[model samples]
Target: MDSPKGPTEWAEGRHGVGPWEGPWPDDPRFDPTLLAEGDRRNVVDAYRYWSLEAIRAELDTRRHPFHVAIENFENDMNIGTVVRTANAFLAEAVHIVGRRRWNRRGAMVTDRYQHIIHHDTVGDLVAWARGRGLAVVAIDNTPGSVPLETATLPERCVLVFGQEGPGITGDTAAAASMTCSIAQFGSTRSINAGVAAGIAMHAWIRQHGDLSRAW
Candidate 1:
């Protein structure tokens, strides 16, 4: 644990980490010692070299109330990336319905910054949504759904999504209070799941999140 003592000293290190007084890496690429030293992932400057547990602990203290849920019936690889996006937005928790394990590579180690909940099915996620007193809003373009911009998003709500090919299942769609879609002029019927998740989260932020309080 090398403490650089002052911001001036800390800023000198790579990634604004520290003067990292400990042993250095021996590799040739930007010094093998630096690479071997600690967690060098591309996180914010505040989280450089910190252990995964340490980063998670810090994030927990400031996590927001909004929750994110994604349907994982087909074991979509996008689920992990969506979770990572939720982590970036500091969503209270990510609910995974229909499956437990998701691909981790796309997450870029951001799963450590997030809390995940596993639900047996869409009904389970709906129950959890009820327990939290959150409005369950699904993201999909379908009849009777409103434009997300016009919809008044609740401060505490669950934004649920589905797989790439099928969108959301009928059961989940039935359970949701509303399903909103991104206004797209492109030829594609829908956007990528991960991109859709990000867009949905930002929409929530615009409506409920205080930009001044965000990182």
Candidate 2:
């Protein structure tokens, strides 16, 4: 990407570049509006002026096999943050269980580039994964759960997260092929669902994803 913005962008406290200084590239991926005006979206430099569809199409080619699921019975605010994290890690899709609507404020607009699917119940999510031959890994610090730090995650799996406060339901844990818990030494009994999801996704990345492919 061309470092087109510098002092002026900083002075205005705006993000991205402002218009094309020279002849616009003859690429179909670039958005006409973005090229004529500017791109202020929360996107990478490589995709600065690209249309939303173009960026999404490009991302679809490289998304990882692993999926992410969140229990949204309580309309958790952390769901958006989890979506943002999943977008960053390039997960195959995000499955929302128990609810169709969720808060989008925490996602910072990244949801437009991420795939989201809704399940009516936890059992539906598990059955869907099983039908596709994908392992379901529940993430919570419940009893007898294996520590995520030492466990080897499957290359193709779904990492399910429960809502904050209540954590994973017993049914959700029971449906999972395995339950992995994060280690914590602090006084808090559990961590935020968003933070936990990020850790778990990174664990999957460390296990099977190629670091060199990341930006």
Candidate 3:
């Protein structure tokens, strides 16, 4: 298990990068096992051969102030996707409410590099946010909810989402500093929880993220 010997070897797999091309870069962040075993993990090019802990530490230095929270009352499969997207957007952490366990298949192992916290109830999640002085912005298409596109998301806020069918619980909605909805034109009544989370996170990014820093 050494560096890919040629260009053809580098391009031969489903995993994007092949291996170290030459002498391994001298960096503490680089994992010896990943360097020797071909570094086939699903990661961006910048993180190639980096240890999981190393990647997490680096992400922590630049993670966005916003957090993502999803209700897990139904053992929602979409929770994993939300975590994956949260990692993609470099969110500070993901809060899982109502249930401690969630399906992680959709995360594609990215959860290993993202901070995840679990709360037993909506009130617990709200308390955690309040202690940190972070606003709770719920995403739900309900009466009195503002359009996410036109609303200003708090810089330090938790973007809470609900399960697919029932939408946000009444208690959760009441606890939110504000609830915003994604605009939909089609006949479909609502979008998937995962999709809504992505939209909401990107909306926050559009307003506060450093566009020039995107890779």
- Return the top candidate by lDDT: 2
lDDT of each: 0.80, 0.92, 0.91
**Candidate 1, 171-194: lDDT as tens digits:** 889988888978888798988989
Q: Output the better candidate (1/3) by lDDT.
A: 3
What is the Å distance of residue 5 in model 3 from its true position? Answer: 20
Report the C-alpha displacement of residue 68, candidate 3, in angstroms: 0.4
Taking the tens digit of each residue's C-alpha lDDT, what string does model 3 give over 10-51? 354646565567887889999988888778777877888899
Decoy 1 TM-score against native: 0.82
Predicted structure with the largest TM-score when compared to the true one: 2
Give the TM-scores of the predictions, in the order they appear.
0.82, 0.93, 0.92
Ranking by TM-score: 2, 3, 1
Ranking by lDDT: 2, 3, 1
Q: For model 1, what is the alpha-carbon lDDT of residue 52?
A: 65
Cα lDDT tens digits for candidate 2, 61-105? 999999999999998889999999999999999999987889898
